[model samples]
Each structure stands twice: as C-alpha cells, then as structure tokens.
Target: MPHGFPIYPWLCLLFTYIRGLNSTVGESRMKSLLLKPRSCSRVLQGHPWVFAGEVQDLLPGSENGKTVVLRDSRKRILGSGVYNQNSKIIWRRYAWNKVPFSMQFIRKSIEKAIQRRPVETCRRLVWSESDLLPGLVVDQYGDALVVQALTLAIDMRLPAIATILQELTNAKAVVFRNDASVRKLEGLETYVGTFNDQVLEPLNLDIDGLSYQLDLLKGQKTGFYLDQREQHALVSTFAKGGAVLDAFCNQGAFALQCAKAGAKSVIGIDSSDTAVQLARYNAKENRLEATFEVENVFDYFTNNRDERFDLIVLDPPPFARSHAQVEGALKGYKEINLRAIKALNPGGILATYTCSQAFSMEVFEDLVSGAASDARRTIQILHHCYQAKDHPILLTMPESAYLHGLILEAD
Candidate 1:
C-alpha cells in the first residue's frame, strides 16, 4: 500500500459508518414523542386537547404550566401547547405554528376577537379555544374586563394576559372570576381576585340606551350576562305594553329590559332570595315599576293556575351536568315550558331558553312541541336565538354553541 494503515483504516471507517447509520435509523424509529409517555397520537390526529393519560413521556424536566412542543409517537412535531403537570388536561394547544407563545400572541388574539364585533361597548373579547387560546375567556363590559382562567396553562399565563388586556383595551379594571367549578377538574383550587389597577365595584353600563349596573366583584359571570345583550335587546323590541313574567330572573336582565320597553307590568320570580332582592333593586334603579318574588319557579307555576300573562320568559339555569342527565333535564324543561305556555294568555308570547349544552337543539324543540301539546295550545315559532356572536363557536366543536332560546306565539 502506498500509505501505511490505509486498508485497515478504510475497513474500520466503513464498519463505523454502517454501525452509525443503523444506530441513527433505530433511534429515529424508537424516539418517544409528546412531552410525556402517553398517547398523544389522538391529539395529533386533530383533537385540540391532550389529556394526562395521553402523554407518552414528560420531557426530562418539564414544569407545570410550561410552554412545550408537542410531538407524535414518531417524534414528528405536532404543535405547541402549554403543559399542566397537575391537571387531567395535560396540554391545551394554542397554535399549530412554531411561533413563540408570548404576550403578543395573547394581545393579538384579544384584539382580533374584539375587532370582529361591530360594537365594542360590551362584548366577549376572548372565548377560550374558540379564539385559538384555550382555557381563557375574557368579557368586556364597557370599560371593565372580566376574565376566567380555566386551565393551569391559562392560570400561569394570567399576568401576561392581564397586561395585554390592559394595554390593548385600555380597560379601567380587570376582574378575575376564577371561581368556576371547572378549575377543580384541573386539580386547581378556585380563586376570585382582581388584576391590574382598577376599582372593584358595581359599574354602570349603557345597553341599547338603557342604564344597567354590573357588580364586577359580586355579580354572576363577571357581574352580568354579557352574552345575552343582543337577546335582551331583541326581547325588548316585542315587549311594549304587555304584562311580562320573567321566571328565574337574575338581576332582572330580561325583566328590566321588558319594563324599559314599556311593558305595562313585569313579574320576576327566582328561588334565591338574594336574586329576588337584586331584581327588585335593579327595577328600582331603572325607575321601572316591576314585581319580584322569592319563590321556586316550579312550585309557583304548579300552584298558580289562575294567573296569566301576555308574555312569559323561562330562562332557567342548566338542569343537566352530563350526557347521562339529559333525559331528566328534558323532563324539567318540558314541565317549565308547559306551565309557561299554559300561563300565556291568548296571543301571548313565550320566550324560553335552555343553557344546558347537554340539551340538544332537536331535543329542546321536541320538548317545546310536547309542552304545547300538553297545554292544549297552538304555538308559532317566531324566532330562534343563540349565544351572541362575541361568544364565537367553532364549526368543528358543536359543544361551544350552548345557549339557545325560542320566541313562540301562543294562541
């Protein structure tokens, strides 16, 4: 050989090359995907959420609420998500892109949602994953902002989100109503606190030229039902000069609107003594003469057959919590609607709603039809209402569309 050790070295080099190639192939095949050792393929296949059981293996040292890269079992990148070590939903994917998950992203998402709406006065600025930001919901009531962080990922990102909200909207106050029961499912404790430098008090808002007070710290769902703003206005359009009955009226949202719309009289009923008192206060605040009674709506309607109304509203709370409870919930819905239809005078209007996602549109319609049959009355469906546009729904995820109401004419 011209060069000493050439043949031996060449053989060794070839052997090493073959060994390395084999090793690389094997490693590629065996590489574990996902932040943890679990089934992440489902999420990769199109599901937006990754449950704790689906994690294949946690990256050597991923902390709770850490932003992490998601991958499939083949080590192929899936997307990016925020990891919650203690939660059953281990990851809430924010984007499919590899872009940095920063405060700017949050700000942009909020801004996009707000910009989509024609009216900026009062609206839902962020709707969790519907806005591509999972577990984060932000509602705007005039200058006030109400936020609910439902996941550990969102909980950890709360400060960033708050800063973005303050900067983007110039919100006077940002109230954190993190008291939803869903937090417990995430293994996080419930908390209600305020973020940013803003006052915590009942703030007055102008909705369709009517003044309404919202108690950010003490009210329901950020002190008012902002999602019902459009529906309230719609109800007011047809309420003039009628005797209205608003069952399960919370803070007089519908009842007060009916009164302001020139309803001759309005009677609001709720089981909670506190809600009844608040409804009365709201009526007085609006300078509207309305009656509020603290009584179980079911009991009140079951016993009082002599009373009738030109219009009746049955916007009750959700009765079903899961799919298994849908049947019973339908019964409750039918019962209430039957009573409402029976109480409606000739040519009266019946506005009914079911906030339960478990109650499908078909089932709710069937319930209304059955109730009309039981009441021995003919009803014409005048309008069907859904959750406001600010609460956007993903076409792929039907569960996001929950609130449903119907306006029926009983004759």
Candidate 2:
C-alpha cells in the first residue's frame, strides 16, 4: 500500500481463477468411460481387453484411437486405455492403475520387452498385451525388426515405436507387417512398409543350427513360424531314423529339422506354391534330402489313406480367427487329427498343433480324443508343447497363449 502497488490486482486475480476453472473442465471432458455393474471385475483381475458390453457410457467427444479413462459405476477410476467405438473391444487396457501414458513409460516398456528374449538371434521382442504394450508386436531377426500395430492407437505411434526400437537396438531396418486379417476388426487398412533399410529378399536366418531363407514382404506372419521353434525340435526327436510327413508346412521348418535329424525320408505338404518353393530351396540350400509338394493337406490325407509314415506333424494355420468361427474350426481340427491317426503306422508319432486363440487346450484335447476314437486307434499323449520361450504368455490373459500342441503315439 505504501508503494501504491497491489500484489494481487482484482482483474488479474479474476483471470487466474477463470483459467484454473477452464483447465478443470477441459480435463473432465477430455474422455472418460463408465462401466456397467460388475463389469469392472475383469479389469480388477488385470485382463487387458475391455469388451463393448462392459461399458455403460462414453462421455461426449470420445474419439476412436484416443486415450480414455475407465471408471466403475461408482465413479472410481479403474484404469486407462486406448479406445475405439468401432471395435467390440472398446478398450485395449494399457494400465490397471492411474498412470499417465507418457513417453517415459513407453520407452521403459519397449526396453523391458526387448530384454525378455535373447536378441542374439530371431525372437519375438514385444508380444502385444503380454508385454504390457497392447496391440503392438515386434519380432527381431538379427538387426532387422518386424513390427505389427494391430490397433490404430499403436499404428499411429509406429514412428515412436520405430524410434525406440532403433535407438535401443541400433536396428538396421524395421518392417511393418500389418497385413494380418485381425487389423480389419480395428478398422485399419493393411499395408507393408520399411522404416529404414530395405528388406532383403530371401533373408537368411539360423534357428537351432538350421538355415531358413524367407521373403519378409510376402512371407507368412513376420516371415516365418517363429513361435514353433521348440516344437520343430521336439518333432525331430520322434522323426529320427524314421519316415516323416509335415502337413501344412509353411516353410518346411519341421520337415527340414527331421531331415537334419537323419529321417529315412521327409516330405512336406503345403497349399502355398510359394511356400513349397521356399521349402525346396531351403532343403537344397542346406543340402538336405527332403521333398516338398503343393497340395491341400486335408484332401491329400483323406485321398491317400495308406498307413506308412512313422511320424506326422500337423501344424495348421489358424482355423478359428474369431469367436464365430470356433465351431467350424473344431470340425476342421478333428478332421485333420483323424486323418493323421488313420494314416500313421503302428506306434507312429503324431505332432498336432493349433494356433487359434479361440481353441483352448481343453477343447483341443477333447477333439483329439474324439478323433482317435473315430480312427479306432489307441493313442497315448507323449508331450504337450507350447509356443517357444520367446513368446511369453500372460497368466490373466489366456488368449495370449495362442499356440498349443500335443504329440501322440498311436497303435
């Protein structure tokens, strides 16, 4: 007062108050979702998928591919996630607690995921929800990285992912293999792109002392069946000094492994001509005596019913891509297993696998039992295998355990 200067002028104080009020309103209106009664229980259990039925309300201005807070019916914060109105999975939960989706968090997640697997060779570095980064998968082969962003939020942040991946690993290249059919459910168009260096055709890789060359641009899911590495070796243990048949051999991985293990004869059947060609080339490249044929596996086994093979491997593609396809998928699965059982010599081994997320181990095992009964053969389960160690599964999210296998000896 003595200096004729007011520390807090009336007009200045009014403006400050109004600014604070606007911020509060803006935050509340950013985006928020309320859950129906008992709907937040799944989130409480740490399942990352939030189905549309669980949601009671979406606040105005809730945009697709935007971050939103999830609250229970009691108006208590549960978590936050990337939301999309078009998807049945309204929210792909990224966190269970009130944590900001900041760049620091993203960096730490990517780093931690990379450390989960041995990076000396090809391995899945980031496995979507299993690694706490939902809708994003990154598989590493040497210095090259294959990335798939299944959700728009993750897709939009591909640049960020590429940066973190490249800076951390000094990656020579990053390929976006976004051609998976699952992207359609997220309203995303499929396309392939390389972020840095050009992808080499017939890119060669060494897995368990076996060499495989693949085209990253056109090859199957990240250019190879990396999840079945352990299964390939396990099937080889049964193929030693015996005849081998590998059905739906995408790249002749199993057949080649059997040939390397000194099988009497190895044959690989695949519907894709490109895959057959690749298989033949691999067998030739490694100087292994193995045969590759292009044919529908079901028709081949059904039409050729002679029981001669000592070991048969059925590593089919996903028959049940979605929940609606589960019924038909079960039938298809049973048909193939029955065919293998009927075509096996006495005491022959059958290595069967299903990569469908909808097919649980319980249903798959029951189908196998029914198929064995239909074949009128006595079968004994020898080993049950899962995806390779690199593809870790989340306990709370059973869907993360996508690959299931059972090796059976038949009489």
Which of the numbered candidates is closest to the native, going by highest TM-score? 2
Residue pairs in clash, model 2: none
* lDDT (CA) per prediction: 0.76, 0.81
lDDT of 1 by residue, 1-411 (tens): 111223453354345334432121121232222645455345645666777667666543235554566776666677766666666677667777554445556667778877887766877888988887888998888887888988765665666677678888888778888788888887666666676334476777776666777777777777778778788888877789999999999888898888888999999999988788888877777788899999999999977888999989888988887788988888999999998999999999998988898876777899999999998999999998899888887765566788889999988
Which whole-number lDDT from 0 to 100 does residue 42 have in model 2? Answer: 77
Per-candidate RMSD, Å: 14.0, 10.5
Kindly list the per-residue Cα lDDT of model 2 for residues 1-411, writing each as its tens digit: 101213353244234334332122223443778889876457768777788888887544336765678888888877878778777788877776655454556678889988877756888889888887879898888778888989866765566667788999898877878888778888777777676435455589887888889677678999888899888888898888998999999889999999999999998999999999999999998999999999999989867877479999999999998899999999999999999998899999999999999988888999999999999999999998899988898888889899999999998
Per model, state how many residue pairs clash: 12, 0
Off by over 4 Å in 1: 1-47, 52-63, 68-78, 196-199
